[model samples]
Target: MASITPWRQLLLDSIQANKHLRHSEYFQLATVKENGRPANRTVVFRGFIQGTEKLQFTTDARSQKIEEIKTQAFGEICWYFTDSREQFRIGGFLNVIGNAETNPLRLKIREQAWFQSSLDSRLQFAGPSPGIPCVKNGPDDNTTPKLDPAEGPVENFCLVTLEPQEVDYLNLRKMKRYSFVKTGDFSWTQRELIP
Candidate 1:
């Protein structure tokens, strides 16, 4: 049996214990042009694949992010655990979950959660018809709509799979400040830093 390093074990523990990190927002940075100029935006993480060690996210087929992914398969995702004062950064190639005909299982879970919450509000936003604007910046600023979780568009969503080849873990502590860079499949190198 192979022995796992302490840092590797800690990293896995943090992900497993939290299941999802709050401060760490998932974003995909992809190259748009040949010059390598990239575009990035925040994305919701669905879950992580245990066996393959890949992270999952959802997006719309019409979204620019999807186009970026198509043009450039490489990207990076960052997650900062505020409560734990730690940051996790992963870099890898992205693969779109094809089969547009079939609804994604991840989206199904998200849809069920949204449906159970506020049927009316969600239906209004996600319905075939357009929804009313919820936000008002000024007397005439009716364009900005307030976010209604219930009114999310389910059909417009699609899943993105990110299989990380490298991950960097940074722990922000006055003492015992540590950073671990995991390269390749399952190997990692730890470095101690001055806090």
Candidate 2:
């Protein structure tokens, strides 16, 4: 089994400490656009992959972020925990497990992510294509209808996994910070940073 990094432990602790807040699970994901500009949006953290440090998230394939990720596989996630007064900026590579994914493990994870999502969340994948101009009284203008859970993941539903390479952790209350860089498969080198 692979060892867990200290930064991962810190992040998990922060999550636990701030679990009461609904937004604690949300993070800002930033990706490089085709024109060299940065694109960012709030995404919910699904959880870490079992036995791995990778972070999991769900996305619609029709979202522009998918194209941005395909163009530049790297992304950075900025997560802030309110109650804990801490933040973590995680830099990593994004892996998309789409409808065409063939890896059994990845496919299983993707399906599980879909099934675990709320019905409203699952229906979003079946709605109109994201990022397109909304038409009056169109699908984009209203909440998506409920979907059957047993139908499984829609074609547009994707499981996004981020394999963290570097992480910057900051504790506002303590006025301290640290930078961690991956040194091996399951190890990292941590350095204290001036807050």
Candidate 3:
């Protein structure tokens, strides 16, 4: 039997590891600010695109991150599974799937994603827009006036995709780490690192 290359193995591991951790799918996303600083925030890891290193997530169009992304598309995602002591740092560029007029496919994807969202999730957007002050005695508070998921693909809905150029995986359990960088079409370069 032949062994798979290091890069392929890393891809396989990432795809699998992310699948079973649905309930705990939060990762820290780091982006560069215009003032030459870094911004880090917690974002849910939606899913991965098969045959590619594209990661998916949803964000509000009014979110400050959207402006940051528009200004600088490059960002990084850090996933640390606390229980397993496994971590992955993914570096990539952002792809904002905006309104239907801009990207029809992204709109459809947003629709589908919305279709799958829970009432609780939909209610989040129904409240205050991202990064806005709470509406005094209004719907600004979370968990009020639940909205149907079917009603969305709201004006604020936006799909954000991460096109990963490199992935660094560290398995502290075994005390090993490596990085895989995409070099070309279906090609990657893997380098072991001292952890």
Off by over 4 Å in 2: 137-146
Per-prediction TM-score, please?
0.57, 0.94, 0.82
The CA root-mean-square deviation of candidate 1, after full C-alpha superposition on the true structure, stands at 6.9
Candidate 1 lDDT by residue in tens digits, 14-83? 6665656653444444445445676756665655543456677655555566667777887887665565
**Which should have the higher lDDT, number 2 or number 3?**
2
Q: Sort the candidates on lDDT, descending order.
A: 2, 3, 1
Where model 3 places Cα greater than 4 Å from the true spot, the runs are: 1-23, 135-146
Per-residue CA lDDT of model 3 for 50-70, tens digit only, reads: 445577888888788888897
Q: Write the per-residue lDDT of candidate 2 for residues 1-195, one digit (tens) a residue.
A: 567678988998898999989999999999999999999999999998888888999999989899899899999999989888999999999999999999898899999999889988998888888778779986557675567778989899999999999999999999999999988776789999999
Residue 162 CA error for candidate 1 (Å)? 0.6
Error of 2 at 19 (Å): 0.5
What's the residue-level lDDT of 48 in candidate 2?
87
RMSD of each: 6.9, 1.9, 3.9
Comparing 1 and 2 on TM-score, the stronger one: 2
Q: List lDDT for all candidates, in order.
A: 0.58, 0.92, 0.75
Tell me, by lDDT, which candidate is best. 2
